[model samples]
Target: MPAKRTALIALLAGALYLVVGVTATDSLLPAGARGGDTTTTARTDTGLVRGTRTATHTVYQGIPYAGPPKGAHRWAAPRPVRPWAGVRDATRPGPLCPQVASAYADVASLEEDCLVLNVTTGASAAARGHAPVLVWIHGDGAVGGGAYFDARRLADRGLVVVTVNYRLGVFGGFSYPGLEGSGTFALQDQQAALRWVRRNAAAFGGDPGNVTVAGSSFGAAAISGHLTSPGARGLFHRAVLASGEGMMDMPAGAMGEGVPAYPHYTWRTGQESRDTGVEMTSSLGCAGPDPRRALRCLRALPVKKVLEVPDIMNAFQAFAYGNEVLPELPEAALGQGRFLRVPLMSGATLDEHRLFVGMAHDAIGSPFTAGQYARALVTAFGRDAETVGARYPVTAFPSPALAWSTVVTDRMWARGTYAQATAFGRRTPTYAYEFADRDAPMYLPLPGAFDFGAYHAGDTPYVFEDPDAQKYFTDAQVRLSDTITDYWAQFARTGTPNRPGLVRWPRFEPGGAVPHTQSLGPDRIGPVDYAGEHRLDFWRRLAGQGTSPAPRPTEGKEQMS
Candidate 1:
């Protein structure tokens, strides 16, 4: 974030505080509520609640869906939150799940008491009645993110919008010996939140049976995982996955370690996850010959002591098998038609890897040399290095840096996205998209040398009404936002993104060799050959021949939603 923009937001927030007679921090506050006068109270399964009334919707925040995962409950499946006695104040969003500090911390504070959810519905009761429900899960490498997204627009569009905060980092995903298949605490938290929605949607003026689980990046992978998790079955009827897919992962030893690490965001077995946790235990000097005793010693350490150690961030913390919750890898299960037959929407950005490589450029100066680009490719793609280079020659691109970003975009992001989308299409009604807005805003400025066009997470502001970023959108972009949100809300309501007045978005044909993926940008919504656009043929050839895939180095947002 730029200093000038930060100061401007601070000044505007201060002005809002004066106008509303309440201090406004970075949290998502209703646009125009003052002195608690909005009569935003409602009842829940657990207790009564009060929210803040805005022009468009009633906003409820800090609603717990599960018990706090702390101390003795650290690695356990989420227990139902105990009911509260009286009406609870819910005007402000809950704190974020504990995480290693990152950009998300700038907006929402961090706390262990973070297994909470937020709801947004029409300000008027009639407007909310029978509205479709949309539950959002956020993704940022599963390290940070929460429910700070402002969903008043979607709520006003006849939808009940629920955003969630789950466990993150090692706290939410760590597994050790004797705790087999228990590393997926974050996923468990999501299921509990979904169950809460199913039980409480009617109270929020939403249709309980018409629910959609939507997310991006890790959040996308998460909902996709839920499609295969027995515990999450029958909870949601529809799904949306953006900037993520069912088959995203890295080959072993691609990131310099014999053990797959950091960029590998896929399912592992219980023993594989336990092995990684043991590495953390050894790093903290809590290792013992008896693995179970070492696990106990690691658990005994203070949460602060554990979180403060920055090295734990690199450990793979995705869901593991060997338990009933997630019986197998979502991709493998999804491949074999083992997932729930829900209507699904999945996509990635046109330039998904720019966000990552732009950050990497911080260390490597602009205009990378051929050797540097090849070395980076070898690091990400391992054995497929030569084939990948032959396909995406550095001389063919404008620069070596451009060529590298293209490989990361194609091989790491687009490849998995294609595999996952077509896989889901094979089993259910599906919609695929490629966010192709080349001039999307750069939240974090890259040096002049990097062009991170339509990068990963770029479509988030379009999904949620962003007060800060929206201020800068051109008329064309605002119209694009309207189109995107309308499509999403329509999908939640009717298991499809198409409506009467909008351009037709054809559903993915289950067995099409290469289905048409809708291209979204300023005043444009048309189908494109997603397979060819991302060069999936090259990827399929590489994968079919048992060649290595690629990965990215870095991975943020305040609202992991």
Candidate 2:
């Protein structure tokens, strides 16, 4: 790959890391709630587990929801945990799934026995019983785990919060020609965790039937898979997708040089995934004529050897469709309204691509020039390059980087998010939002003079309590955080975010007088012209005029970053 393309790939990978990867200042464990020493115990289906009780909430960590997926269980559907004979400690968190550390994130792990989950419920909610359940899935297809998020804040709002860890990278997503659970082991692990929730939520003071599945970035994309997966039906009553790629399509050169546009940015056909696996078999020293024997040899290899494969973990990041876990591509399923009829809330940040564009320039150690921006347009939009350039002139923005960021953010992220929100709104109650705190804190350790205005994953700290993040929040930002958490908890409780006192969020009516998309910011907290702000009309016209060529399949390596 060329230097530009390599830098772009690193930029994309760094974006993923910023979303869910652990920062140096991040705490691995949540702060203890007020008033300690009161122990609480919950009886899971397997056995009794003790937890720490505070005046505000009760937190249970490192609870096994499924049997360890090691040895013969590797690459197979998750199995039930063997019932324990005595009490199991639920204080510290379990190890994270296998993944290599990256330049942007500090997380690295090689543990395969990592199928664990954490539960937190408000003390008042536990006493009341039947509190609505919020099941959280952490972001990044290859990095991070459940314990990264602190659920104590959300739990305090009369909700039972459950954060889960599943397989990651090659350990969870690798597939072979004869693999029984080709391309879907991680997804299957998530389903198994949901099954565990269904059986044991009552013990944790949650209503099994009133469950809301929520995630951001890759985790949100996985929820999109579950929306259409037969195995996930009735497992969740509501869904929240923040910065999900359910309807995203990558433009040529948007990710890297020579990388063609993909209709489904986060999905792959089972055959394609299997072919990639076959290509890797030789690299793994397990080449053979028989598929079954090759798979056996591949499985017998140590986890370190699998991790050692170049780009192996990122190769399997895109979930394989046309398999049992996902019978069809999630983007296609979502477009045709073939998903379950559930209440939905979906949105993205105002400057989603700024993080990627800024990081790309930062990695290359040069400013994004106006000439480079023009070339990028031609590379991405093809015949519509001049038209796009004319619409978004360099003089219209503060810098070339912001201009390019706005272009991709509108054409790719905003367009996809708008389409998904309208699709869900047409079928079920939907709430759309735009995180518009332009001055949101720069939590990542990125050293640059770029203006990262409410960039990708910037809204994360508002939902999950991070002590490092909280220290940087201004008074207004702190209020915004409380309001956002309330909205989430209220939505999980009642199917809708509307309640007394806070700004009334209306349903997203595509044909209404104005499709209401709550603009979440410290200064402004009401509906904003989402489509107009993102210049979606120009993108819509460009689409109508046939700008780019038809989508083509790119190598899995190109899809990851």
For TM-score, the strongest prediction is 2
Per-residue alpha-carbon lDDT of model 1 for 200-236, expressed as tens digits?
9888888889899998777888887888888886799
Question: Model 2, which residues run further than 4 Å from truth?
Answer: 1-11, 21-26, 32-38, 545-561
lDDT of 2 by residue, 1-561 (tens): 111123346336645665553464335557443345577788999999988787677888889988988877788899989998888988677788888877777677878889999998888776788999999998777788888888888998989999999998777787788788788888898999999999999998899999999999888989989988999977888999999998898888776456667777788888878887777556788888888777777778888888887667777777888878898888888776778888889999999988887777753467888988999999998889999999999899999989989998999999999888876776678899999999888766666678989888889889987766778899999999999999999999998998998899998877775688999999989999998999887898878843222222221210111
- As for candidate 1, its clashing pairs are 138-560
Best by lDDT: 2
What lDDT score belongs to each candidate, Candidate 1 first? 0.71, 0.82
lDDT of 2 at 294: 74
Provide the lowest-lDDT 10-residue window in model 2: 552-561
Q: How does model 2 score by TM-score?
A: 0.93
Task: In model 2, state the lDDT of residue 177.
Answer: 80
